[model samples]
Target: MTNVSQLARPHLRSLLMHVPDGILDAPTSVGTAVVATIGVGLALRGARRELDDRTAPLAGLVALFVFASQMLKFPVAAGTSGHLLGGALAAVLIGPWTATLALAVVLLVQSLAFADGGVTALGTNVTLLGIVGVWVGWLVFVGVRALLPKRPASVVPAAAAGALVSVPAAALVFTALFAIGGQVPVPLDRLAAAMVGVHTLIGVGEAVITALAVSSIVAVRPDLVHGARRTLAQRPLTIREKVPA
Candidate 1:
């Protein structure tokens, strides 16, 4: 059999260069519309929650923030500069479902109004930002809470870690899609590794931005944070479990 090390090398690099730059088509536009509709429903449902009353405005703010953030893309080593995939940060701030809706609105406005991302590629962007970003951010928050102390002090770390992981996760998803439908003829393994590696660095930026945003909110109103609520609920258990141990 081919050596495992040899096998993985090419695929890693593939992730970095792989972009669906040329695949924009009719289906992509329709896809965005569908996500926007679903996203609207999810947003409305979350907004009905009492907590969401506060979180809803944050959602709008998130849309605005994402719009502005994308405009100031920083130079990555790749020819492609990267921007914040704020879905995870948003989800961690509010909730995952609400985040999905918020990012969808951001994307819709970007495509139809601002002409930022390709109107034909709205599907790709939504899948990357709306779906992938939410899950990555949420999972990282859950993980940080599980690994760290249960005190409210852990909020920044958990959010920072969540935000850090969120970016590369989105990058990996894009890498996968690019593998299937990439314009460039690059090896998938190399592409994945390159994408993951660089994005891992970019994720640091994502982490910093997300952590700052979460900390600002937490500082003003800890009760407004859904992640904080979970942390609080799990607090009493830490002492109980510690006593048993």
Candidate 2:
């Protein structure tokens, strides 16, 4: 078996999931920025319906957790690293609209404060991680939940499945954007293959973490888990009537 350390070659330690400033041409960057802006705008409006006194605190906690999780990186392949995208985790724990807004906030802070992603490439990161990641994971979670038995426990596996697919879906989107206006002249097929393959590995780790966290919360407070709410709500209420003694 290949040693894990051997895969950990030294590379620039910036956020792996985030696109840097110069990788994308100006037109591509600008176009993605417009799309990201529209997505965030929609999120801002939609989140109002998703957020209430009960969920408001959880949303803030989710954003904080995602921000911290993205900072911690692990070696994936030769000279490359990966970290939690947290889109599925957020979307499953909170609603998708609130999750989108939360991810946007995390990305913005990472870009501005930590410079983890580039200032110019902020929009691309938001589009990829915030919008695409959030929605795809949410949709997948919904689909998986529908297939499984309607129980609160089902949310754990469904959330994990969503987290697994979300990472690569975002990678594919990035590959498409890169194909359009990549600063470097790389073959599209090879780039897509590499990105999808590596991110799939990363997705496994994402799924595991998401499962653990979601299961823990579901065990303690299933009510707070947005994805599991329907399953939990569908639970039949039991009432006992005293018979004549």
lDDT of each: 0.67, 0.85
Q: Estimate each model's TM-score.
A: 0.76, 0.91
Q: Residue-wise lDDT of candidate 2 within 63-140, one digit each (tens)?
A: 999999988887776656788899999999999999999999999998999887788989999999899999999999
RMSD of candidate 2 to the truth, in angstroms, is 4.3
lDDT of 1 by residue, 1-245 (tens): 01112224433322221122344234544554476567667666765662445666766777788778866666655443566778777777777777777777777787788666665566667767777777678887888878888766677788788878877887777666655555555577766667678788778877888888888888888777777887777655434345654
Q: List the residue pairs that clash in candidate 2.
A: none
lDDT score of residue 31 within candidate 1: 57
Winner by lDDT: 2
For model 1 the TM-score comes to 0.76
